[model samples]
Target: MSAKPLTAREAYQVLRDIALGVRTMRRLGEKPLTGVYSGMMSV
Candidate 1:
């Protein structure tokens, strides 16, 4: 992967994909939990 930050449009697309994936997972009865962190992080 390139070590470049995503552009505004790219970031928006990523966020959309993430939201769609979460919705799909929920529909499939999958408990997808995302963990929020400041320094250390996880999903």
Candidate 2:
């Protein structure tokens, strides 16, 4: 069976959610958490 299509608003909301998730992942990945751990181990 074919799925129903989303309305314009639904499509916009889905795009917005996807953009937000990508931004969050980018921000988290930008942080150098591994370096912090290495520094802690050396001290």
Candidate 3:
């Protein structure tokens, strides 16, 4: 069966939820964090 389409508001809310989850995960250090270095830096 085909799924029902979501309204614009619903779609926006879904995306917002995903962004919040990602931020939360970063805050919790559940994923490997990365940072950018300036100038010649050693790895």
Candidate 4:
């Protein structure tokens, strides 16, 4: 969201939001968000 890097808490919040959104989408029968999880793990 910015040119600068996120702080640890900010990063955590962002990731948590993504996970929640992914879960919600899952309930709606969307595809799994392995790309996002894998990207984070790779980093």
Candidate 5:
């Protein structure tokens, strides 16, 4: 597997995007993904 290394700012932006996506999914009633995100965040 090939992984691209992101700069700190780039990584932060990616994380922010993911956070927004998860929040939106949660608001839209995506229970499975919302549970996954909540579980991961608690860790």
Candidate 6:
């Protein structure tokens, strides 16, 4: 399927969300050292 491109505001919001997610992970990816890490991950 084909769709039109997002408007400027829409694109900004989308990118903002992605950036926030990355920033959040970067800030919390390693710390505390008190959690079980099996073989899978979910959010």
lDDT of 2: 0.51
TM match of model 1 to true structure? 0.46
Q: Report the backbone clash tally of model 2.
A: 0
> Per-residue CA lDDT of candidate 1, range 1-43, in tens?
3357778997677668778884232222254435432232112
Q: Please, what is the whole-model Cα lDDT of each candidate in the order they appear?
A: 0.50, 0.51, 0.51, 0.53, 0.53, 0.53
Q: What is candidate 1's CA lDDT for residue 25? A: 20
Across residues 1-43, which tens digit of lDDT does each residue of candidate 5 receive? Answer: 5557788997677678778874332243334554534553210
Candidate 5's TM-score reads 0.41
User: Could you give candidate 2's per-residue lDDT for residues 1-43 as a string of tens digits?
Assistant: 5558788997677668768774232222334665534432210
Deviation of model 6 at 25, angstroms: 13
- Candidate 3's residue-wise lDDT over 1-43, tens digit each? 5558788997677668768774231133344445543233211
Clashes of 1: 0
Cα lDDT tens digits, model 6, 1-43, are 5558788997677668768885232222344444465433322
Error of 2 at 12 (Å): 0.3
Better of 2 and 5 by TM-score: 2
Query: What's each prediction's clash count?
Result: 0, 0, 0, 0, 0, 0
* Candidate 3 local distance difference test against the native: 0.51
Give the residue spans of candidate 3 off by over 4 A.
Answer: 22-43
